[model samples]
Target: MAGKIRVLDPDVVVKIAGGEVIERPASVVKELVENSLDAGARKITVEVEAGGRRLIRVSDDGCGMSQEDAVMAFQRHATSKIRTAEDLYRITTLGFRGEALPSIASVSHVELLTREHDSDVGTKVVVEGGVITQLSSVGCPAGTIVTVRNLFYNVPARLKFMRSPASEFNYITEMLIKFILAHTDVSFTLRHDGKDVLCYSSEATGGDLRSAVAVVWGSDTASELIPIELSTPKVRISGLTSKPSLTKSSRSHQVVILNGRFIKHQGIALAITHAYQKTILPNRHPVCVLRIDIDPQLVDVNVHPTKAEVKFANEAEIQRLVVEAIELALGRTIVVPTIALKPQPKPATVKALKRAEDAFGKLLRSKLQIGTEQTAQTDLTASKTHAVTSAENVVMVTTPETKPSEKHVGIGISGGELVDWHEILMSLHPVAQLHKTYILAEAPNGFCIISQHRAHERIIYESLCQKETRAKAVQWLVTPITLNVGQAEVNFVVEHLEAFSSVGFEIEHFGGGTLVVRSIPAIMVNQPYAQILRDIISELMLEQQMRTLEELIDALRASVACKSAIKAGEVLSIAEMEQLLSDLSKTEKPFICPHGQPVALTITDEELRRHFER
Candidate 1:
């Protein structure tokens, strides 16, 4: 059988392993960022061109490695972070695997320029396709600068899977945001094609996380945060969250960190969503940045090669701690009133009026005063001629009493004050709530529906969303509420001060794990403020497991809708129903509310007839 198969090349085996580490541009970004963090770089800069497809440059002012260490860095599994199997269980460094550098070098053209602080000369190395082509001594700054080019050149299939430059850039930006959130004390700058996208500088204050977040996300987000400080024998949790009203339609805004490492945890996300339940609409997400600190032995960071997900020894306890922290922080904040505003009606078009006239010609014409003067003039002329022929200077003419045509009358009412109301209702007809959630009204052939809550939610959402980036309008409360929480919950509250203020909740940290609440969301002013906040937090904790802050916000909006919606059994007057119908007709997606639930239902005339069997 010719001794089975020929032996595989060692170079090919290395190249295959490289494929596992460097999958895409985002993968490259992750490796480079981790390397910078490991280098003890207080400041780092990343620049990309062509969405990192053409070039990727990372420069850092960390204590550069010696010539020997720099040369050994390109070898697989060569790491200073770990010495044995036990070290893997307790990893503190960001890039402990050491495979990232070697793996990356195997797949692309890489150039490294690094010099130790004590060395007068730097070492330069160039590697292409897993082969070291050059190594030389050169004079350079006391730092390291790595440039990678032509990624996946050997693998055409992988290159083909790359997305457009814009999309790839978005991914890079997202990765940058994660790093920025994780290491707020480290100043970072990012540029795309020589254009600065982000420039963050850490603050001397302990809240560098918030400062960094404000720079990348916006100042408004920082303002909405309520300070959270929580500690326990087993765990510590802290971070910020957007108020229920500041929900978004996407998860782009949520950031979570586990033990100083950025990660995406479904359990934590679901907890946040649970907290915002009944406060935000469905499908809407909120803005949040949370960090969890726990004993190193309690969590496993080696579950994934990328370390973006982790398994905790006591996940349930961690979840409880996080939820409790957020709940307690919210309880201390004052609840303010949120005013709902009605949307403006669209102006009537000439075509619409013409259509109405065509449907009921004489009735519409009479009601609108169209051709009325001409009819009166013709009647007067005929009466004058008849009067001239009369002998006693008075015309004794028999005239029939004119009755209004049914077709000429508008819909709803016959006459009196109800006439205007009837006309308005008729003009707004073919009204139906689409998806049983939003109201849809006929407009020419097509129709529009209103998302009663989302429309209101959007308005509030926008205001709160902006507060994270800009100065927000704040309302004061008359009474200050006190809330008691554990240590970990306090940390979470402090992390999200700006997010809280944006939604009109004002709070201050009182001594000994107590928060003083001064204001709350205006919409929920009449309700039990403390209890509502507590419930929201509890729900947030539950939701954090499955959703991000943005998703949680949506859940909260739905919660608010349920509490504020018109009750099902309540009777509505004709005018009230008409108004509701008209409003529903104007909405964009009136058939469905923020949640997936329908806002209204419809029974066709045929279906009604069938049901009655008339």
Candidate 2:
């Protein structure tokens, strides 16, 4: 028999459509809170129990609904945000989909109580699983209070997919933080399990967003941020960005607000990253609360179901403005890195050994057998290695031991002390820094240039790797330092406490979103251990997505290498350059950084002569 097609039941259709908007407990919070914001609410309260699975409540002091409007609000496709099709294009409110209320009501047991300021009585509507069970007049305050119980109870399949209580709560906590940051004029209070978790007053800062940021991310981090405001003929951008010295591992710290709504756009993020090119490390991202205002007609906010993503008609132009804004803010910084250089005696000899540099070096050389001694100095182009180009000379080799996503390159160092000029590093006397970035040296081959950051990164990476494999001991602190982070970061630290301990960090909870660091790794001594640890944790969080415990330690090594490495734009003394070259020669992979960036490049004397036509 042939199968016949039939339309689903009306109730089943409503539930299916509602599931799209109310996929998880966090989704419910987003819709209801956005409704509160759009309703001209001055104060909003959010309470949840059992990670929003058993109960969810949202109350607001705003224009409450009338008896008639309260009943129709739960019907599908009913909205007051807009009326005509033209209104959709110029949406200024946070929510205009007309699906949140009805969709939410269809999936959970919902109770709505509302009373206008002029109304003598309030309306009470009880709905269970998209069906209206009761409706009557009730006494209530002026505003709206929505209570949802047993979310996803009607759909056991959806309920089965919910994450752990703590994880779900983390998502809700993060969402609320974003809303609070976006609206400084609205007072927000959040409670979990009957305990007050967050209480922010709108009047506390006099409408200052930085004060609001301070309340969430801490005062020290707030103080380190720079203000950004730029205007073009077509677009305007205004926001706050942390200094280059302050960065996190993930892009999660960056919040991109499009027009008046929160959105995620890759083009804008790329523009900001390009602006911080040489100042911040590649793996780290700056914390920014960027708001871009463009003509509503030039953007589309209906791209995603949750409205977290948006598309711009002139994306390239908008990206340009984002870069210019960040650059303008960074240009005003008086960043003068102080470098201490002590005079060191020059060596009498420079020589090369025929044997490989290290155990790893031996294996690399024997397996690749890349070039002969005579051609080694001449084959400097990118093709001889993996994706090695003439411009960058990058060769990324991936091994089982290394991260699959990370690129790696092999380097050859002329081993042993020298009595004669046979080594590349020593033979090429390092003269000066080129724009305070690359080291200019006179090499026997022709010229030797070193990337200061990559060179230092290699040295530190190898040192940390050794320490990790050897079960390094912690260097106890005389005065313990306390680190302040957000609640989510604190939870992450608590969960990975043992991982930190394995890397020689002795930290413990000190109550109130603070962790006291009693000791740290010996290699990270004399540096800002607190900032370093934070960076390490940030890096670990990213790597944890695809890495195991053993792999996490390797990722930690890379992070420590980047953090402790000497930064670009730093003035180096002659002695410092001498020591850098000397120390670099001793590392296992002297020519490539841990992240596979080239530490040094050499141009042969013959190639130089050919270019000169000599």
Off by over 4 Å in 2: 338-472, 494-513, 521-523, 526-528, 539-614
TM per model?
A: 0.60, 0.69
Give the worst 10-residue stretch by lDDT in candidate 2.
344-353
- lDDT agreement with native, every candidate: 0.62, 0.73
Residues 1-614, candidate 1: write the lDDT tens digits. Answer: 57878878998888788887787888888898888888888888999898899988899989898889998999999989999999877888877888888888887899999998898999999999878899999998888999999988888988888865645665676688788888888887778899776667764534376666666655545666676668998677887777665655456567888877898788888877766665677766767788888778888888877778889887877777777877776776665767645222221222234444232233222221112232232221121111122232221211124343322221212112212221232354444444444445443322334444443332333333343422322334555776654222343455445545545567787753466777665444334556465445434433433244455455554554343344333333333434454433333333344544444332334334567895
Model 2 C-alpha RMSD vs. true structure (Å) is 11.2
Residue 571, model 2, lDDT: 71
lDDT of 1 at 577: 37
What overall lDDT, based on C-alpha atoms, would model 2 receive against the true structure?
0.73
